[model samples]
Target: MLGRGSMLVSSLFPLGVSGRRAGVLALLVWALVACRRAPEVSSDEVGEESSPAVLTIDAMDNEQHVLRGGFSVEAGVFRVELYEGSVLLGEALLEEGRWSIPWQPGVGSEFLEVVAYAMAGTEIRTRLDFQRLSFTEPEGLYAAEALLALPTEPDITTRYTLDGTAPGPSSPVYTTPLVLLNKRGQPAPLSLIPTNPDTSPETWRWKPPATPPVLATVVRLQRFSGETPVGPAEARTYLIGQGATSLPVLSLVTDAEHFFGHDQGIYVPGRMHDPSPEGTAGWGTGNYMQDGKEWERPVHVEWFEETGAPVFAQNAGVRIHGSGSAALPQKSLRLYAKEDYGPESFQADFFPGHPLRDFKRLLVRTSGQDQQNSKLKDCVLQGLLRETRLALQACRPTVVFLNGEYWGLHEVRERYDEYSLASHHGLNRKKVVILEGDGLLDTGEAEDAIPYAELLAYVREHDLSVPEHFAHVEARIDVEDFIDYHVAQLYFGNEDWPENNIKFWRHRGGSATPGAGDGRWRWLMYDLDAAFARGAEANSLGRLLRDERMAEPFVVLFRGLMTSPGFRERFVARFHWHLDNTFAPERVLARLDATVELLAPEMPQHIARWRYPESEASWRDEVQRLRDTLARRPEVMRRLLQEELGSP
Candidate 1:
């Protein structure tokens, strides 16, 4: 489940979670152990016509923009998909017996058929669960709530509570129009109350579950759909006022099944100040801050129904909106940044089809120190804030990430101040976002780290996760070579799959050159590559031990860059030294096979370019075409290593 940036869904379970996905290869150079649990879904759950597995939502019923999407079945059961008509989408694998169909769309309201079909003990059956909905918004509709209506299926129940929790009856523990922070940490306007709290007041005594809480405990609140409370809203308000002083950490459970599993957080239109043709928007003032780190000026808090902020009260749970039976993993509704990399490669390496997508929740990260507790502040500043937001904004994203240098110590402070200004403006978290200082850096160096520490401290003192990208840019160019490489890998890999290399650099490091924003392509290759290699040593890929993929293109570049023939020899000598010094040459040679496939076909391109009357094949178009061809027939990579090394 782990990828270069985060773990995949299937990788969540331990191998021993079940004996089914266990085994090992002798070479010991293993791939990943994907966790898959097959759920034995009943036909009624899927709303089938005859069998146990049925089509819950038909084409006409559910309108979706795209036909293709990935799905996660219940862990371990290996539910099989029995398709009667219409494609279920991408490569459907049957690991551990559950069927997962990638999203594939056919016409608007076509007769798309799907059934649960998995393999178990030689038996296969069709299985399916919730169906999908196709929604088309009317012209000029600018807000989320405009198009999102309460789900009509009585079996479906939808309630909005920003606290990260599941749904249930009596979950509406607050007065109607509950105001709690949504995922973006913005206040969502939603509250519920019991009809007769004075008489049946004990019913409002709901509590939250303990563990990696979905949201801040003090910010937690719970709500749901059911009979409205009979008592006065003020009576319940008094109860809420009293309970807020001593409630446990909050968890909100909501009936997500009724709402197309949509956002249980806040949504605001016209809250954005800057919008560009690039689809990138600039977040000015009034944007939500994570928590107590917010500006000391005591900013005003507003609760919009579609989105909002949780009422922060120490010792009291925030708010909880419990999702009904169909609740998906909370992880699905978060967001993150895989932006900023070295220029080693121009292309980005990330899982296609968006990673942090289909989020039904968005909460703002806690800002500064008033964050309920010190531990909570660290979690918010360190990562929990950034990752959670990234998980929620999952889509074909084009974001403006704060890249470049540490801009120096004082500069970050200036930028942080601007960040404060943006928060007071009421900008929702989704638009005009900032990648924190740590997330942008990759090395544990003092230069890179100190600025982030300052940023984090400021957030704690002020309670905001966002630093001023524009201001921090003044920190200037201080890209760690290692930082550059990770930024580069993240840029080139195209998919953030788990990396098995000896040196795996993560971005929670330090300050960097501020101006080195995501826009600077050249900075990504050379600067980032060096940053990535900064910490690399012993067995890590380097100049001397070139993988074929690295060698092919590199040979040309190496030759091009070498000041003299001795330079080439010195390079080769260093490479051999890596083999001789660290790894067994033969073993290293054998293991370095993935490189071969990359270079094989490119050899001809190189030869053709070399043989070109002058610069014929060396032309940019030709080089690009060659690269594209290689990318398409990447298996040609195998030929590269074999032919170059001759181990076969």
Candidate 2:
């Protein structure tokens, strides 16, 4: 005869693991039987007329032992306390004979104790069972049909879905093991298949498909007992591909409950489904999967990726990475590779033999500003910036997965910091001085700002129209970089500029190499998310150049430079050169179209996952808005420039 716990384990076989691995089943059964002993009833323990006996305690979902859902208790108890060993996990209040409590089981919490106190002041203790679900077939690159099976539990039905939707009681029920096929609806050819059979009269050859098969399938499973659901649904995505292409696919897998739990997951705070203002604090950490192993946690991260062959994998630290977009449910992320977190580098070759290899930080940008539409604005602007030879971060479009669930499209970007300066310019991290708007020092000594502050003070005090004072100001800064930076910002109509998102860096002292340690401030192009307005509005170029209220130090420098005849001539000539070349409609639109082509195929999948648009048509409408801005922005700027600084 089976113990009560053994009977519970036997009840889960119907949840779809019977024909698969036998060892997993035996282990799970043994675990459940050993952990779920019945409550101890004292000899004096008795129920009064007002209080019923504490009958049974069971996990509402019998699929896995990690409790992330409500539990059903057959007790007329008023209160229940749950514990892991001696530590109290949670407590619940019974209402009208039923109690529901939300609990997150800790790692290695094999058995949980549930202590119930009846209305009659009698207490009984029972143990709740737990077992980690195992994916019988490993998740990775597959050339043939992949088999997916779970350990069998009797009297339970498993329902599943493959369309990236969460599985529910109404989803397709699994009767046989799941077989994932390629696009051709055939099994991937095995290596043992003979190209030429011994008995064949003619020579035979096999030809593979021209394009490698790309399969992004998300499988979610829920267990059920007859008409009632037994446990919470578990899901995983199987991404199979030949190799990394121009657009690499990143596959991230972690525990489902940890990624989606109500209290602990990244989506729990203010993003995802919660609509309250308080939910905005939704930053959390989770394990990053790479090379077929779990990386563990305390590396803060925000999930938004779901498929393709993983080229780069790391067990590095991560954090929610944007200032403006961080509040959005679909937030950006920053990954760090540091000694404190166990890894000193992100491991996989993200850039592969590039200068970026030595850098330890990376950005996963959602393009959230334009997420509802084109999703190409920032990429397009950065591409143009690179063409003009301005120092800026590099970007690559990638599809991201969060714990095997499709997160949508993200741009892998280079983060600008001490590491970036060291990698790109071959400078010492400790000696580099990075300053934002108004000479606010981000790195190096706070005293380093004295020179920049003096320059700003000189621009305010002296007449820059005087060649001597203008020359003095020019010596303190990189004139050409400042011009290009301002041109790019004005052309893009980026409203967050001069006063916001501006960054410049310089070495602390003079260098032995020519132009290396000039101590002159050079701007770094970044955060162009607020550019390329879709509608006709007054251009910011004219207003910023002429507005006295916009007294940001950078703005003051630009205005002071415009006061000089030589400076104005160079600025105007540079502006027109960019207008006719870089920002020209043909050139700009060509770049935009090329980006759109690369991103179009993946946009629908991204949209489907994030609900960023009602349909692809809506997405394209946003793209058209960007196109219109690119086509008309140059003329608008030219007109604004002529009006503000006189005809070039």
Task: Please provide, for model 1 over 27-104, each residue's C-alpha lDDT reduced to its tens digit, 9 standing for 90 to 100.
Answer: 111223232333577877786544332222211101122222122332222333434255434333444322334343
Per candidate, the number of residue pairs that clash is 196, 24
lDDT of candidate 1 at residue 301, scale 0 to 100: 14
- Per-residue CA lDDT of model 2 for 339-456, tens digit only, reads 7644576534455334555557788888855665677678778888666647777777887755433456788888888877776777787788888888898787869878888888
Q: Whole-model lDDT, candidate 2?
A: 0.60
Lowest summed lDDT across 10 adjacent residues in model 1 is found at 404-413
Report the Cα lDDT for residue 34, model 1.
30
Q: Give the TM-score of candidate 2.
A: 0.60
